[model samples]
Target: MQPSHNDQQVDLANTAGDLVPANPSTFSDDDTLSGLEKGPSTTVSSPKIPIPEPADVAEKEPFLYSLRTHKYFITVTILLSLFTDMVTYGIIIPIMPSILEHMGGDSTKTGVLVAVYAAGIMSSSPIFGVLSDKMSSRRKPMIIGLTGLLIATIIFMFAQVYWLLIVARFFQGVSGGAVWTLGLALMTDSFGADEMGIQMGKALIGHTMGMLGGPPIGGLLHDAFGPKAPFYFCLAFAALVIVMLSLLIEVRGDEMQEIRKYAVELRARDLANGIEVKEVVHTSLWKLVTTPRMIAAVTVTTLEAFDLSSLEPTLPYYLKDRFNLTEGQIGLVFIAFTLPTIVSPLAGWVSDRYGAKILCCCAVISAGCFMLVLSIENKPLWGIVLTLVGIGLSTSSFIAPILGEISAVVRRTGDKAAYARAFAIFNIAFSFGMLIGPIIAGYIYHGLGFKWNCITTACILFAFVPIIFFWMGDRKAKMEDVAMYEREEEERKRILAEIAIIKAEKKAAGEA
Candidate 1:
């Protein structure tokens, strides 16, 4: 037990040699050393470790991936921005008349205040659209737009003069054009055509809520506190959104590289699947926009906006005159119009599953029919509400489908990069519709009556059906685009696998 020091050292060395293994080759087959070799057999217990697939990983930890994280965050951020914009704009509606009356401004001036915003949007949308596409990154334009919104909110909060208010509204319009045009472009770019309908439908909910809740919230705030209360609240809201945009939104600067990487991956996947990747031919933006298909989609959107704007301004007046209804009753009629729009996402889902052409055509025809019926003299209150609800349902189909169609067409035409401009054109068209609808409806109502105005609008809506049928083609091309996109995604995964293999080999060599 008490051996000499040299004897103890010899005994320790013998124990260490036994633990180390007599032959290094004996340890090569160990489970812990599986990846140490360039080509290790997985016939042992390695398969039991249960490695996860990419999709499973992505699903389990979406936030860990940059692409998924950015997409989800941006989608929510844009919706909130849209909601904030709408609420801010709407809140002013209930209070504007009072403020104008206090300042001794006439009804004409109030109309101008409303119309000027649309004018600003109409003028700025196209310019911003072109600029976004040309810019290195979309984030700059988005930030600039949000900054404009903040500045406009500050002006609304502090400015007492009517001219300053008008100026502030113009700024707000410019900001709106930027946000909608650039935001939509970003959405289209990020999500692609396949998912656009649902994404748009979801985003539209924010717009609807803003439109529905803005005036009431604004009125309550103004009534409870003071004129400054709504503005101050909106200013704080805008500031918060701006901070969110600055911190959270990320637009990859090297978008071309990313796209090419995706394309390469797709190519590799196609090779594995025994498919071919064909070179695609793209059309010029001008040629693309001027096409019958593009025109029809744009016209559908414009007419939809026209119908809504025309109805909104005239409804209260008509309700007041016909039913001798109080403000509360008039508000209920507006709800009837808005309630159908709640199902807009369902319309989008349907359009995505089926096609936009038939849906849009049917929507236009139905809306026109309802518009004609709504003009009936001495119509019952229930009948009027039903017609309004029908109109809302039909109109709800217009936006998501048309926007989806535009995205599809742009992708089909090979102008995959021009969605921003295309949607910008859409924004411009909508702005024009908004600007003219109320004014034209008012003029007709003054000259002829509400019935004549409805008649004219119905005619315009009816004209869209034939155009849609003739211009908007079948869904064959869209299916092809989807195939192409999926192939590319597969190629991306294949390339990633090769990269992983190479890295693994290098790591194994280093360890050896």
Candidate 2:
């Protein structure tokens, strides 16, 4: 009455997940790990044989492995790269007026320079994004970009003519494109999409610092050591960034790769499960761009940028004329506008907990209202500063939420999400907004006074708030997203479980 050996073979094949099916002699070598072996011939199932912990198959730790893998270290290194990129961009500001005069250029040429830099960012970001995704590493592109910045700095230092200056600015702009694209993509790779808001907020602190501090530092250096000094200052930072990046490790390359692969395999097995399995999702670029939520995210980023950059050209003049404030004083007032944004980390934290809708809606509304306050006539300087600060604070809503949302959209593309491309779109939108804002604001300010201009911008902000809040978030969508995230978490645990078994079998085989 005993079953034949062939019956046992077929029964084990059915229950063991996947049987070798081939003759056992083919795997007769002692090294044939049981990962490819039958689970067991009995009903209880084979004892869990493989459990690969972090200790198994992990790349050997390199010098400063802990430092390289630390979240804070990754954040700070990116922060310095962003700071250096912005500093190089801004550090030339104080010197531009005098330096341009020597080259027979006027304010109009300066505007051209600004536009060109923005153009460079707009045009080059997508390329960097593609390159980043193709190369599958942020370190190389970042180093190349920073090195390009150093070369641009050298050009700026020696340029004596208007055309040479233009070339240098464009080069700097190209460098800016690479830095922003690769830097942001790197951050996305290092951190989870859920935590993107806070991470982006922290990284942007470098941007704010560069913007606020760059001109002052440039002015001081110019005063003491001439036009070359700011560029010289930038050179030192560039070298430091290069060194820092040299020490930088792409931990995701080593760590998440195997897990992701296992996740993909499991996803294939559960075809209805909707886990993204590609290492790089090949979703058409336009397909992503056309998504409603993606549009909303891009709109928020562009509008926020347009509103902020609009002030750059018009606000200083308004401050100078209305209050008889000196350039130094005007700079101080603008500082108030930027200072509120220093709390972006908190803003990002809020975004992670509650979603981007409420934050973005409230922020835009507050910005519109505060902008209306700015249009009020004869306000005291303190009131103006406070209003600017309020506007700045309102702007904070866009930073983390939009960033997180973009990454979320990419994540939904499943495993093949190309973060670099998604953020490249973001970078282009922002650059476009920055490029056009001043032009539009100048026309409005001249034609209709600052009042209508604020009113016009406020109206635009008003229109988008609903889209941000309602289109981006709702009861049904929120529930769906929650469920999806839970599913993803469960799948992650399952993938880890599989990893455990696979690694454990290999270990057991080695011992046997």
How close to the true structure is residue 277 of candidate 2, measured as C-alpha lDDT? 32
| Residue range with the least summed lDDT across 10 consecutive positions in model 2 | 6-15
Candidate 2 clashing pairs? 50-500, 50-501, 50-504, 50-505, 51-500, 51-504, 52-500, 276-415, 281-416
Q: How much is 86 displaced in model 2, in angstroms?
A: 2.8
The positional error of residue 431 in candidate 2, measured at the CA in angstroms, is 0.6
TM-score of each: 0.74, 0.78
Off by over 4 Å in 2: 1-51, 54-59, 91-96, 102-108, 216-226, 255-281, 317-328, 444-453, 474-512
Q: Give candidate 2's root-mean-square deviation (CA, Å).
A: 11.5
Q: Candidate 1, residues 314-390: lDDT per residue as tens digits? A: 66557767887644456556666567666767877767777677888888999999999988888899999898889
Highest-lDDT candidate? 2
